[model samples]
Target: MAKVTLPAAADTSAATVKVWDPVVRLFHWTIVTGVVLNLWVFEHGKYAHRLTGYVVVAALATRLVWGIVGTRHARFSDFFPTPRRVITHVYALWRGEDARQLGHSALGALMMLALMAVLTGLGLTGWMMGLDAFWGVKWVEDLHGLLANSVMALAILHVAAAVIESVRHGENLPWAMITGRKRALGAHDADIAD
Candidate 1:
């Protein structure tokens, strides 16, 4: 595995390498599993479907908690894009000059926000659907389907972005997310610098 070494906080002569915390990696894989299982079980197994929905809700809740109290990179503040910065990023992308980031970029952050919104909506609607008054209500059922489809679409875009970034940077971004390691940056990363 490749390791990145930066100037140590205590001593410039020594390099202090930082790595993602375990909670960050756990949340990532758990969400991936939860999303896949939710989709698959919903299609093929009724009981499993509901069970997986609960799992997804749990995972989402965990992610929200981690975002507030976890490591630096895991925090929402670390990756949430500011309006001005997001606009600048979009302009840079149009100019083909966007920088590589250690965490999610502006567009990536937007996608994440969308995905989280959809997931939250789905979870709430699913819960409501379970109530006696709301059970089998056509609008609630349709909203759930709509949110599910949005999640599917966002998943596709997420994968595509990862693939494109990997190809562009000659690094396995998905693997980096899984393993929580990345190669040290170069001068280009310094220049474009997110």
Candidate 2:
């Protein structure tokens, strides 16, 4: 039998590299669907709404565990933003520098963290509302609404940032999240090992 040959990279300007793993991608979309359902489809304080919230909570819990044991880019250690790094990244963007990170950028990582935290808080408050002791409590219900609104605002900002970064770096970031791959690195691109 003839040996199978792999395709040459010379035909393309950049190679394709795996960035997000399947688990990460699944979790990302699952959370998105859950949030959308909770926000627009399901009636608030209903069983379906609460169920979707629980599903989102489960997705978040899995993501937290994955961050501990997942692939390089998926791990928290790889992209957890420090203040200095975030500052530097912001400065680079302000200067119109091409800081093409293979994984989530510093600001992106911070946004991810914030989104997850807000989601967790929403889940908690939602659960509290279900408890008999807290049922019909105005403050608990208000906090839940606040968290829900926060999630929506943060999600909008996240999408806007992704679009801006995609244009700046010449990569389709949202597509990358769906496909689990990104354009390969060029000389000026920042290396993020997976």
Candidate 3:
């Protein structure tokens, strides 16, 4: 997770602090790469593509650990959204009035959960295909395809939301994830008072 600090205030200033950590940023991008590789593998039926799935599984495991032991902003607790909050936020979004959050928004949190589920399902199904009993099983193949499609759809939605939020907040959030240094909102470096 990104570090927070309180810098001395400049002349008449107010700012929000940075929130994303390098590991979080890395996990985000690596997942994207893994997803793309999986898609390519599916389309081309390449053995290498199957190998990349293992990489994604590993990355997800790493991310899960980081969520527990990582920086303040990177922890799952920092952005887990409640159902009520998601409903409220969805209503606000429909009405062109949404609340700002330092971390993932309510819907984003749901999407994260969905993505995790789909990925886990895919990994498990793929692993089963390697087992003797499940070898060359049609059902496993079909299930893998279904989960892969779902994951891809969710990923598109995630990117779209990130774009919209970036526009609304005037912050290049995706880029921030890459660099690990978010511009402080004001002269006062502050921690998210979550």
Tens digits of per-residue lDDT, candidate 2, 57-111, equal: 9999999999999999999999989887788888877787746887888888889
Candidates in order have lDDT scores of 0.78, 0.87, 0.77
Window of ten residues with lowest summed lDDT in model 2 = 185-194
lDDT of 1 at 155: 92
Candidate with the larger lDDT of 2 and 3: 2
- Runs in model 3 deviating more than 4 A are 1-16, 43-45, 183-194
Q: Write the per-residue lDDT of candidate 3 for residues 56-109, one digit (tens) a residue.
A: 888789889998998877888877777677787788779876645567777877
C-alpha RMSD for every candidate: 6.6, 4.7, 7.4
Where does candidate 1 have its weakest 10-residue lDDT segment?
10-19
**Residue 110 shift from truth in candidate 2, angstroms:** 0.6
TM-score of each: 0.85, 0.90, 0.81
Question: For this target, which candidate reaches the highest lDDT against the unseen true structure?
Answer: 2
Summing lDDT over every window of 10 consecutive residues in candidate 3, give the lowest-scoring window. Answer: 185-194
lDDT of 1 by residue, 1-194 (tens): 99989875654222222445777777667777878888777879868877777877887888889889888777888878788768988998889887766667788778877888898899899988989999999999999999989888899999998999889866778877777876555545522224
